[model samples]
Target: MLSTKTLFARTVQTTARRALGTTTTRGKHTVPDLDYDYNELEPVISAKIMQLHHDKHHATYVANLNVAEEKLHEAQAKGDVAAQVALQPAINFNGGGHVNHTIFWKNLIGEKNGGGQLHDGVLKSAIENKYGSLDKLQQVVNGKTAGIFGSGWGWLTVNPSGQLDVVTTANQDMPSNIGHIPLLGVDAWEHAYYLDYNNVKADYFKNIWRVINWKDVARRYDEAMSKF
Candidate 1:
């Protein structure tokens, strides 16, 4: 017969295994399947680029995240807080890469079905109130994204007060770290568009609008607004 304390310890260990993504030693983090085919966002984004970005770059992030977590767990078991702290950057980088790319894939679609338009709604009003107009918001977002010195992201996020704001993060740092709720995030890492747009990041930024999924953005905005 097990003591109450023993049962509690077993339950905690089980939950920890699930949270660390190591329930099965042989298991690896899997790349999420896109809702649409690679070519589905054609014209706005190339199929070749999409395939490489999703299957290669984003897959690498997921793999690295799993590795980082494993290392962090080892450090924790040894009671080495310094080693655990050192692992923070790797965990943030890979974890953020996974999160940002996941949202990026969903926020894009073919333009034929009115994918990019921000119809009049709560989201539109919020944007207009914050940045004057959608075009203005795009200008700010594009400028911020292009200005990133290296790999990073530009985002339109909602603050706790429910006000829309444009912000940027260096490397893979997420908006949540800066006290903002990200509504839409644009990956500024060269790998995101170098194959298609080459050194012309501005061109890529400008063209991204054609595939922007306003519906998804609106949904995120609505949810964030509710939290305020």
Candidate 2:
């Protein structure tokens, strides 16, 4: 058996390697590939909308985020607080866009794969308890989503108390910024519905439910519960 000092040295070396690996790989954001084709969510979101939203919009966020982080790192290395402060908004916007869009993609599915189906389970039960039923929950979500003044997101989050709650974040802000664990989100930005719904945001909210991936929401709910 190795001596205690030798074991300690090996452990320290291993931890140092992990820390360096993490630092080297940090801030290299990439657009997450979707499981279904962009056309798969048609009749609700439309192929054109999905194509632009995923390919152009989300990819731009990932690219800009990488650039902003690189600049920020340089600022930090030189101890330039003003430069770091100036970079803050870009980091938050692009970072939140990346995070939100990643979740948004997973929260969607084609209707053929039981996309809108919400079977009996803890997640369903939680919805029922909170808003009386899943349909009511959708109604609530739609009402809240429609009222968003501009580009924003509607989210069903696990609040700090671990209860199901509805919240809205404006202009690419993330739900986590408000101490909520997002379970589902709907984009209210015009780009998300402009090609399809035209100016009618309510229609987009109503139709999006048909393509919602409830299974993914349920999985997120379970995981959030595990933490709190």
Clashing pairs in 2: none
Each model's lDDT comes to 0.80, 0.84
Q: Candidate 2 — which residues are off by over 4 angstroms?
A: 1-27
lDDT of 1 by residue, 100-166 (tens): 7887888887888667889999999978888889999999999988888888999999976778988
Return the top candidate by TM-score. Answer: 2
Best by lDDT: 2
Shift of residue 55 alpha carbon in model 2, Å: 0.7
Where does candidate 1 clash, by residue pair? Answer: none
For all predicted structures, in order, the TM-scores are 0.86, 0.89
Can you give the lDDT of residue 47 in candidate 1?
93
